[model samples]
Target: MTKRFLHITTLFVLMISVVLTGCGTEPAANDSGKLQVTATTGMIADLAQRVGGEHVEVSALMGPGIDPHLYKASQGDIQKLQQADIVLYNGLHLEGKMQEVFEQIGKQKPVVAVTDQFAESSLIASGVGGGTHDPHVWFDVKLWSGALDRIEAELIKNDAAHQADFEKNADAYREELAELDQYAREQLAQIPREGRVLVTAHDAFGYFGKAYDLEVVGLQGLSTDSEYGLKDVQNLVNLLVERKIKAVFVESSVPKKAIESVVKGAKAKGHDVKIGGELFSDAMGSAGTPEGTYPGMVRHNVDTIVKALK
Candidate 1:
């Protein structure tokens, strides 16, 4: 079916389901009495769980190694969104295909773009133009902390009875994030100035480089859907050779072959760049692992980059 037709069908089904089931005006908590939060990505889900602690049960539509840029909502995902008390997502076209779904759901319930509160000046332009901004704001710990505030506000708006709980949780979580930001700074500083280059499979690390003061080069554009020709690979290879860069990292959400190609090309030119490590870009690591949570993922990326480049 056509993409537009599928979206329409999904919306129709969702509305019918909501009407038949009779969505109540009360907070949509589950039997356990926790606010049912549905987030578009794992990172946002982590934020919701952290800030909504003991009062919210969170689910992420896109999980580990899943790319939100090309993700289309499945019928199951629509059901999750329909059942959620509040929906959270990264804005700026991060969930490109699901924008219409979020819009439709917003008519019935609270749908929040966590990045909506950010100032225009704080965002990085995609440079591919058409006035697009990079959606990977979570790479910068301080910026991602802003999302906690937004999420907390929305939660309180939806469930005011627990405003105090949300506030306390948010404050504690913000403190953890503050420590993480400092840790990232001190660790990344170990890499000498000449070696502070981060070459990755895609341009997902622009915010990371900007936050951490590393020069980042990506083999592909912001979205994984963006195509990369031999010219792109060759250009990156040229940068690696010219700078004598020793490592290039792959992304968990993107194919490894892209960085592998860059490495092969660099090798062909005698630079000997190795695959530094896999960085969690659009996705986190598997569940129950250190690399799975946002702080852990950021720590993992920082440590990996420093180890390879320092």
Candidate 2:
């Protein structure tokens, strides 16, 4: 989990050069007649593939365990966006560095924010200035299902001939989401109310907490771009000791050092706080792995939390 930042001037120059030069292979409309789709995250790519089925070729800009908060667009990503027939991303400023790039690309093709269908009132404000909403809304299966509507609509609009296939796929996927939500509720309910506290490296589980009745705490802020000072560590340590919370978690995309420090602090205060397990926050698990997909990630989180807290 390296926190790397790219210079804005460098990125701007690279993007402009690419846009002006028109380098790289221009995406042909017919690669077996598949609609060229590019998504910013794996979750969005998975949705596009599921809905578009054989009719679309989807590419994800960010892969497993890559923190989007610190992710910057590369020359290759810019080329992919230019070649794509449609682009989809999670908009709450989640892709912190790529916002300007997405805006610039929107002028050329259909650039869609999958979560834009959500009303402002439904979003949780990122208390850190600049008016950002928590981007990890997929943790709540119900809210995530809403994304299917956007994906389906975009696919149909772009390729009207595949409207029937897109609708059929979306309906099946929604049913799977409903089952996943039920599975989450049933599994999470087993943990005692007091043991439902979830402490992690960053504040990425607000939606999960609201949907599953857990209390979440993070050493850092909504975006992993923020730092956790000694004061932040001390406060969390104090809370863990006072509440006798059994476990805290590490995120797959964020560094585990903050979580480990909190555990050490609690031990000094005569409390034993164990590192529960790694949770998928900003990114999903590896491709072909169980946790690589959305449902698998959520189920793994629920099982891990239940075992550690209960």
Highest TM-score against the true fold, candidate: 2
TM-scores of all candidate predictions against the true structure: 0.92, 0.94
Total residue pair clashes for candidate 1: 0
> Stretches of candidate 2 above 4 Å error?
1-6, 13-17, 20-29
Please list the C-alpha lDDT of all candidates, in the order they appear.
Answer: 0.87, 0.87
Clashes of each: 0, 0
Candidate 1 residue pairs that clash: none
By summed lDDT, the worst window of 10 consecutive residues in model 1 runs over: 20-29
**Tens digit per residue, CA lDDT, model 1, 160-213:** 999999999999999999999999999999999999999888898888889889
Weakest ten-residue segment in model 2 by summed lDDT: 1-10
